[model samples]
Target: MKSSKPIAGRYLGYREADRAAPYARFFNPELAPLAPHVCAALDRGGVPDILLPDIDQATTNLFGGEAVLEDGFVLTSDGGMRVSVRSAMPSVTPAMVDWWFGWHGDAASKYKLWHPQAHVHVGWRETPPAGASGRVLYVGQTSIVDEYIGSDLIRGAIRFVPPATLGFTDKSLDDDQQATIICAQIGLGDAPIDIGYLAHHVRAVPGGSEMRSRFWMGGRHVAGRNLIGGMAAVVAKRVLSVTESDARALLVHCAQEMPHLASFLPELFGEFKDAE
Candidate 1:
């Protein structure tokens, strides 16, 4: 419910020279052209197709079998929202995908590179150990981010977790070359309250990988960051009303940002994989 105006001002504190100094040429405000399938997805928008309670089944569906809905959104029966999006990462590797999640949270400028037009800031609550990197830094960490999901600029606490923790199997998760899943609990920036869950499944194909992302918001996943937050979560649904418009914006934002990030992530990771 907070406006992005003050949030924008808060993180706009970083100097462009200092922030872009490392990534230098990679910081681009203009977005790369979206993949053709992404373009078609934008045009295919319609009514909410999946229920929020169906999120468990939907999550199961994406785990092993063919996906149920690649790019879509729905207003759940429980007054929540469900969103799905698929991005074909032509040359991005699973390792790079994991690395980006760990690295981008350290700074606003680095976060902006993922979606220059939308991302405003990223700051970690507690950074991983001194030598930690890759999935090590991400799986047990939280990143507070401010970004636009359409016209609405929003702030989120993206808390990453292990694939196994989110129900991914050993078989499905065995080989990093085969697949890598990034799972998270989505929370509010100010309050210690989680409102949703998200999984971005990146499966290796011939040349690159594909990211299948699903989000369940404002329903069963809702929880307080602590005991009090947990108690408050009981009425979370009544107070936090998620609308069809919110769902649509979420779909559009994901559709645009994922592929855009995929375009440059591989190169960015290769360059900064060893740096802080």
Candidate 2:
């Protein structure tokens, strides 16, 4: 097997701002295949897990487990075998999510992918615009429009976000510098996107008190109640019946569980939200 050092470097490159292109970035160079093996082990009726130390050693954590390598071991428990890796687990992207569930066996097909569909931020611009007018632009996923046209019977009716409303820049960066790079790896970057705080709508006043950006994932960002927050948003849609505060709570929890799920949470959740 390839050494973990090279793999870690690859990860860093993928997470960087400049190389963080959707579908173009690396998802799981060495660990993706393990998903199927782990799933197969779990089918035997025990908790199964995989632990990756850096990019090299992979530890198999199981309910009634065994040692897989010198640097790795499996932990077995009643709830399930806790798979702990000395190294950090890569964040799940849309493509990775699909692969994990798709190959996990027959039981995984019903599982729903989860992540924040849309994120919105609101705050005041204490400083003036860097250039001309403050920009407001939207990034959209092609699938969204395709699905819209497919179900709505609308042709040439699709709307596009003007460049003025969105900030479009291409730059390469390291994982420490940008998290969006990770999002692009697994294909979630293509979501219907809209960024920047709006000044005035049809009837809304031009207020500068709050500068915000909202995120919409399309379906649920979470799978079910069991997996709340990002996961729920990925798989299910937000319910009007639920209060915004509660919905946010779910998001907070999701961020806590999967720090790499999205890149902007550091700004959204404050400094602590940024995890290695």
CA lDDT, every model vs. true structure: 0.75, 0.21
Candidate 2, residues 39-141, lDDT tens digits: the string is 3433333222233121112111111156542122222221111122111233322222222211211111111111212111111112112221222211221
lDDT tens per residue, model 1, 29-138:
67767666666765766544542225557556685465365777777767777887788888988878877888778878778777777788888988865445433377
TM-score leader: 1
Q: Which stretches of candidate 1 lie over 4 Å from their true place?
A: 1-4, 8-15, 18-20, 33-36, 39-42, 46-53, 130-136
Model 1 pairs whose backbones collide: 48-74, 192-225, 224-229
Tell me each candidate's TM-score: 0.88, 0.19
Best by lDDT: 1
Count clashing residue pairs in model 1.
3
Specify the poorest-scoring 10-residue window by lDDT in model 2: 195-204
